[model samples]
Target: MALLNQDSDENPTPGPPRTTEAQYVASRSALWSGVSALFTDGRGRVVLEDVDYRPARLLPGGAIDAGEAPSLAVAREVREELGLTRTFSRALAVDWVPPGAPGYPQGFPGEVIYVFDGGILAEGDFARIRLPEREVTGVRCVEPALLPHHMGPGNARRALAALHARINGTGPAVLEDGRSISPTCLDDLEVLRTPRKPQLWPWHTGPAPDELQVRQSWGWLFSEDGRGLVLIGQDTGSACLPGGTVEPADHDDPARTLRREAWEEAQVRISDPLYLGYLHDDTGSQPCARVRYAAAITDWEPPSLDEATGQTYTRLLATPEQAAQLFDWDSQAAPQLAAVRAAREELGLPAPVRQQLTELPSHRPIQSPAVR
Candidate 1:
């Protein structure tokens, strides 16, 4: 029987309410937005959230409510998700995810996400974390190296870019999709490289990335007078800095390698090592990153390298002008030399020592190439 006034042979229900086409269009025209907060644990580890209903891990924060500010929305989500009552410190970045990604379901529009700095958590705050069982299944502290696996490409970029901006004090960053605009902040950005032949320092294809490459560490030994130390190759009469490959025994510590190299090549004890930076070299089939450090000679003994294996070196000190003349601006040692001056100036040390042109070391440099 027809329920509503015996209408035809089909059963009918109550009429539904409706909205005008204008209202529908107004809603679809503007894109949706959300926010996430990056909470780290004093250490370089970040807090990642595992949603019960999703496969990918996300930062803790969510959607904006009607007529609510994004900042307020993020604070509310953080409160709801982490069981805390706190707002974000400030926004770290803004990323716009355009529509038409295959990852999204059919007809699903894209979104703009704002990432806020959730300030490093103290020990007490970390202990108080309580995940909402309905939305969050688990929470884990992810190291910097492991972030790429949890957060998708876009989010990982946002997190890392934000972290770098914070560390380098470069202010808030801006990203579209996932890459930095204008001044890219990649730490290993190749601005200067040695002009070695055959393959050259900066590969035509660019430097090989960290994951699948080898690393070498060196110490730019310096004195208070801004004089730098060099090790003269006994075999070839070439002048070069003290450094060597990052052996597996060093346990991935560049500083350790620097200390070991200084001791092995020159019998010099360098203290207070400050990492200057690196040069990404692709002069060979195996890509290499020559990590440079600045250190002051605390004490020294006679230079030592076993002559039995054709590995003997003599330590020599060069004034800044002389060193500059020795390893010109285009040499691989340029960054380290420049860094030595910058570091000394930044530290408010005395200016580099000046020496006459005749004081320059007279050495036949057959080949002073980067350590293989």
Candidate 2:
């Protein structure tokens, strides 16, 4: 009689395996969970749901049903958990764990957790807000800075760290060790490295005549990640944050100018503008213009094609590291990159993980100048 191959056998003789009935639990039997970040009024105050005996103050989130999209699951969970109408910002993070991981409730042999940034609309009386009392015991709005003191173990800290980056800007911060805190929180600590500057030609064309000078405009610095500002492209070789000159038609509202410029350049529509600060650069000997604004973008959509030019500008979403790489390649954007890094650091943003790329030799390999 032919013998079964032990490695391929479906039912090989049991040895040290199957020590516990739970160990025999099929992976399919695992439950998936999601976490959410509820932003109230764009102030970076996030609502964390208190689940039964989980020992962590978590974002309002829950499990994804089999075959469900994580993004959809998070939105559904937010509504179900908070009983408030809301819309999610971009997906923030995804985490997975093996079944029976400590801290997870028993019977969850595996977990695929998704986290999203969301906004709450139509805030009702706290007493009237509906939640499944069995699963969620309470809901509280915790400031990003203060979350470390009250969040539950493990994932809560990671979620809070992302939130802090979203709120305070991107940079490094300290996280409590898992030995004394949840493993999820321990993973929240991150370091931001200096951005890499790009190489390109200078921005001076020997001062354009005043008649040809573009007026300085201002706009809010918004980001899809809620971390940094978005820049629009101009005739200058580099990219520029969305803002345009104060035209006679602008009606003296810099905020309106920002909105119009965003619509025109990036095709983005923004509401509820905030003031960041002013930036003036005349190094190029071009007409001097100063921009006054704040970096606060709560929502945005991708750019649409220009009806006239049919040209589409790319909207890049990057961490500080990636931005540095782009800046190093594009000379015109060097100043803007410096300004962004400075602004982020001055605002106490978390440091990014910095990696240095070695500089290439100045001389090129010998080759024919042209095949022609």
lDDT for each of the candidates?
0.64, 0.49
Candidate 2, number of clashes: 33
Candidate maximizing lDDT? 1
Worst 10 residues of 1 by lDDT: 190-199
Checking candidate 1 for backbone clashes, the offending pairs are none
Write model 2 residue lDDT over 28-85, tens digit each, in one string.
Answer: 3545555555454222245677788667677667667778776777778767876765
lDDT of 2 at 330: 38
Candidates' TM-scores? 0.49, 0.38
lDDT score, candidate 1: 0.64
Which segments of candidate 2 are over 4 A away from where they belong?
1-41, 52-55, 87-89, 120-128, 132-134, 164-372
Alpha-carbon runs more than 4 Å astray in model 1: 1-28, 187-372
Evaluate candidate 2 by giving its C-alpha RMSD to the native, one decimal: 16.9
